[model samples]
Target: MSIHVVLVHPEIHWNTGNAGRTCLATGATLHLIEPLGFSLDEAQVKRAGLDYWEHVDVRVWPSWEAFEAELPRLGQPYFFSTKATQLFWDAPLAPVEGTVLVFGRETGGLPAELHERYADRFVSLPILSERVRSLNLSTTVAIAVYEVLRQQR
Candidate 1:
């Protein structure tokens, strides 16, 4: 079983950097969709102050379409969004070979079309407070991936 975390058009380096670390920590693969605001280059990533970038498993995609084309090849792609009706914990995620949890950019989340396109597979972290909108990219990924690990165990 594997958990792949896909970030669409991520704007920050640290979030991606930390996300990479998180993926590495949890035995997950990090897929980054491009048109990125920050650099993913080795030097640029180091500015985020993480020393072990070399060990991080990261893949860069040119666009969401391109990423989506190959996403299915990785496994089932599950969209993560606050707007989704389904909760992450409620979903049945086994440690299967083809399970991916996809996320959107920090400011602009998964586009409406993408969300609507994959509504059945969309999910979110349960927000107890009605006022809470969403979580930070890295934090969200952490929670989702940990939940996946929990399910796997």
Candidate 2:
């Protein structure tokens, strides 16, 4: 199953650029929901290199509501959160299948209610540092997305 990466209210350009590259490497679809932090053409993003950008498969959704409406209709499964009890390493992921791996903004992460609602589907990458609150946005997505691919394989 292909992993879909969703970023809600993303606020950085380089992070988005790195994420797109990761998706390209992993064969995942990158989805960005507005409002975004930088103009899509920001120069900082250009640093990630044009080659990866060319191969990156990305989808833009106008709003969160629009994404929610389309996700189920398209039969794409999703996992949301960084601190979820379920570990991504253990979650059932498949190769060549269509599933989604959703992430929130780097600043605050997902809303409490959204976390509660998707609790079952949520999967987290284990952190050795309780002192370290979270991971880099792109880093987290890369880790989780690959785990999904690993499981599926």
Best by lDDT: 1
Residue 21 lDDT in candidate 1? 88
Candidate 1 lDDT over 1-153, as tens digits, reads 777889888888888888988989988888888888887677776677878788878888898888778876787777899888988888876546668988889998988999778989999888788787888899998988887778877
Q: Which stretches of candidate 1 lie above 4 Å from their native place?
A: none
lDDT of each: 0.84, 0.77
Candidate 2, 51: how far from true, in Å?
4.5
lDDT of 2: 0.77
TM-scores for every candidate against the unseen true structure: 0.93, 0.86
lDDT of 2 by residue, 49-99 (tens): 555676778888999889988887444455656668887777665535477
Clashing pairs in 1: 1-95
Q: After superposition on all CA atoms, how large is the RMSD of candidate 2?
A: 2.3
The weakest ten consecutive residues by lDDT in model 1 span: 90-99
Error of 2 at 15 (Å): 1.1
After superposition on all C-alphas, the RMSD of every candidate to the true structure, in Å, is 1.3, 2.3
